[model samples]
Target: MVRTAAAVWCSASAVVLAFAAIHLNPTRSEPAAASANGNHAAVKTLQHRASQPHDADQQLNDVYRSHTCGAVAKANAESAVGQPGSIPCIGDQVKVAGWLEFKRLVGDNVFLSIRDIHGSVQVVFRQEDFVGFTEVRALIDKLPKQSVVSISGIVTARPQTAVTEASAVEIAASSLVVLNRATLVPFDHQQTNVSEELRQQHRYYDLRNPKLQHSLQVRSKVTQVIRSVLADEGFLEVETPTLFKRTPEGAREFLVPTRTPGQFFALPQSPQQYKQMLMVAGVDKYFQFARCYRDEDLRADRQPEFTQLDMEMSFIRPIDIQNVIEKIVARAWLEVHGMKLELPFRRMPYQEAMEQYGIDKPDTRFGMKLQNLQACKELLSQASVARGFRVQVPESLRSPFKKALPRLIKELALRNAVTKPFNGLPAALEDATLAQLDLVGADFVCIATGDHAESVLQRLGKLRLAVAAELERLGHPLRNPNEFHFLWVEDFPLFTESDTAQAADGTMALEATHHPFTAPHPNDAHLVFTDPRKVRGLHYDIVVNGWELGGGSIRIHDSDMQERLIREVLGADITKFSHLLKALRTGAPPHGGIALGFDRMMAILLSARSLREVIAFPKAFSGRDLTCEAPSAISDKDLADYGLKLIAQPDTKL
Candidate 1:
């Protein structure tokens, strides 16, 4: 049942204990050779003397001996694990039963420790105390680790025992029952070098690891907090389609073959189209913990399926959209981190962020802000004159980035910092900055110049990150994980030349930078038709610590504007969007919303190295479910029924 990228909802207890991940390794466990079905029996020898030691608190430990055991001690163990409320239930007889985890024994006295999901309590056994049950006495000595045992005992106060995280009281058991027995533990999961492959294969055992349990608990809590805040703010939770039509030009899709031959349903890339229609249908506010799927090659930040906090609001302006999202974000911070994020997070234009940090999602924790070489006539002359490369500028300046990217990438490879699949950024970068920017080393200063401003900034952005990594190793704390630098990058261009699009004569054509529905900035209205490059849209992306956490835009509500932009500017066909086009014609209200990468945020909150750490059963970067060996070939009969042909046979070799 290990489905790749399956959505898991969180619970309240999980949320509270999510961050409580520190492991309480048992002070004592059975020796490795000790097994339930054992033949070669070896036990650590214990000192036979069991007299009143000078340590009075240690002398009173019920686990060591039954100093007090009687019929009076037989109530619920949970109420006695810790003192009930403010009052001590020290003398209360408790009937607590849970799996036995740890034990210690002296020659004449034995100790048994048990724990339930709720709490842990100690049980004491002495040979003299169990007079009537010789068989039970032998069983107690033979019981394996993780044996399910229930014991009735009197809770005795131990004022002399060392006060630690565990309860200050012990239970002197008058009765015991071994409900079930467990075999020897499978492997040493605590090993630092334990492979992820092993963990995924033995995932059930992996979850038993306290650290992973805590992470999952935290994930549960974060989502619950977000859901609560959204509900209080009047956002209606709604369900959207998982199986829908293909958005062929968007992120790659996972197609589900249908009953009809050659027909298939695509898993949604986002709840984008449906959520917009909801706005048109007068659902003023809509949200979902949406399950989204995309079939692109995988990375640490991506899964073939993932969760997004899908939201849309009607009759809202650009700031209105930003305000609500900021509120949710701030509330999450306050609840989890106990700090108020600076009200109305700091905003920068797309151009400003790109120029300053070399990336739209800038990690502002460190100061390696890119300095424009051209800012100084001397620096510009020095940069271009020494170790220079050339870019062939194109006449159209359309998709010019494609032409400019190669040489700069080659330069990065020269430095041994760049490689294919390069953008899989770490979940957290602690204090990594462009220390190299300040270093006076005997090497060429990296400079990017190109026809398209975006192309130049994009290349520089990659180099900025590369340098940041190098700086961290060089001892610079530029991208500090401890810092929360939430940024709003705004005024993104409304259109860019689509890589997949072509003009009538086979030239690249323009498409919405974000989406066709995004509204052009009111100030850029004049430039929409005149110069697409300068026409900034009311689109924004929210980032933290260099990760693009969420993105949204003020959607185009005006029918005439939508039509003109689609037909005259972008040259996209209008007939296919008839439903949305009709809704706009019928007077759609201005709407906008943002979708937060929920899983990515969890990774950040939990300090995980990858999204898979937060996800329950995430597929590997190869897009295969390692636990179940999925992405396996479909049955030949089913393929034939679906009228599909094999392009190439799947390799049947190891």
Candidate 2:
């Protein structure tokens, strides 16, 4: 069983001959086959000599693997490699490459699991067959997990009682070449509970996790489906500049300094203006997988830089844009998830959504719909509307009120409330209200009241989400995670009270609800000059399972309205948007568009808790790139080149 170097060469020669006959030429005369085999073997010998590591360096760059682990597994399944008296159709001599995921030595057999992007396979190296089994096993043991290796072996049926976690068919390895040895990883890639900081810091290792791998794969598939659907809809894929001018929509923008003093190029928050300009340029329909940046506080769904599925169209109404978007979404869902979405998604006006669900992006999967307590004559006299929602306390909690009440109060910011047994209901509540809400077993009532019904409902909306979360924690979930609820929330007010700007009279200003470019609703157009607050915009938001997937609006092609909204209502500098205003004046067609948050969409589709799970290299919660450690400090000389200087150091360490 102890083979020498000469014996190893002979065995290698035999493998080369077998590979040539099985793969190079399956049908040949005996003499021709023998001659061809000899030539191939000689070539293989020369390759081996050329690939030999010089001195102590173990790197080999010439090993060409012919098969993937996925292909090997497929071959096994299709050819019935594990069935009795069955032979696989794949050639016996196979060369495959991947990272070493696992390894074990049992008796004379060495079992090693190799994983590539497509899949993983098990390779069994035996002392009887491998000349330097001891040496190879020692090297494999010394190498770190995830070390890159190329294995040359014969594909064979796994033993009936092998009891392995590998593919049905396994490889009997003749030789193993260490392509690249990895260092000790910070944490095991198989671990599920690794800290987010560590994961983000070591994203390369994080990507090795199967969950992330699958998420990335699904992301790619979703993108492909979207592209295909958009292309089929006659939409041209366009690319807009990421380096854009400073035109504030709402969010803070990341500024890139120029060599000129006090001059900067701001990263685009979206491709809104560019796409509109494209519409003016006579590009009837356009779409982009646009890269957008926002200098804003981080959240589970927000990233500093993200991809947006931006689209625009000319000479179209709101319904036309909605129909096209619906088609793309329906096709994407059907192709990627094999789920047929109901045609023409349900639409809810902004007023109706706020009145009923307390939020524009309502999760229709569950019914904790807010109640109008002001419906009662008694409560109506006190406030504009008494917004309340009831949640059933699970029986699992022995002290339900003691555990849930404190959290609910803090979350909802509820200052006024009454806690009593179901039998001791408040006198203000009507019997019909109780019956309609189905509050028989419910032990908790969260209510918010104010003179402004909108204000009250906004607070109660937070309570609704908080209550649902509390119920889930208490072992009773009102919402189904598996459900898909698509809704179009429309009829938003054209202008809202601005939080930042002020009027010339020192009073609060009005701002565009969606954007200044959004046109007023046709019926409400006359109110724009009379009562702008009452005028509604021709805007529509696509909501799914409590998330605002995307939104769009019919844009104003007339420069007068655009300029008025920017200069008068919004109190914004008209000079900043002169380009857009000029484009609008140049016979621009009435257009509309939508931009879907690609990261948020993927996260919801894959059931990921945070956008980070779907993103390849996401920043930490503080908008810091943990992988590259970005938002780094600039050297004084580099800053001088940009004609900038740091006036003061940060209050906290980065």
Clash number for candidate 2: 0
Misplaced by over 4 Å in model 1 are 1-88, 93-162, 166-186, 375-453, 474-476, 499-502, 505-507, 563-576
The clash count for each model shown is 13, 0
Runs in model 2 deviating more than 4 A are 1-63, 77-91, 162-166, 375-381, 393-402, 415-423, 428-443, 505-507, 650-652
Taking the tens digit of each residue's C-alpha lDDT, what string does model 1 give over 99-181? 67678775765677676543456666655543323433455556676666556555675446533345567776554544456
Instruction: Give one digit per residue, the lDDT tens place, for model 2 in 1-654.
Output: 312111111223222111222222221101112232322221122134334445114223333466777666555545644432234434366677888888998998888988876778888877665344565556556767887777766777787786355456887765565556676578887777888898888899878777888888888998898888888889999899989999969889999999989999999999999999999999999998999999988899999999889999988877888888888788777876788999799999999999878888988887777876655535534666676777666556637654666667665556554432234457877677787755555666666677777787887787778777776787876778777899899999999887777778787788778788888999999889778889999999999999999989988889998898788777789999999989988899889888899999989888899999999999899889989988788789999999988899854578
lDDT of each: 0.64, 0.75
TM per candidate comes to 0.73, 0.87
- lDDT of candidate model 1 versus the reference: 0.64
Cα misplacement distance, residue 27 of candidate 1 (Å) = 33
TM-score of 1: 0.73
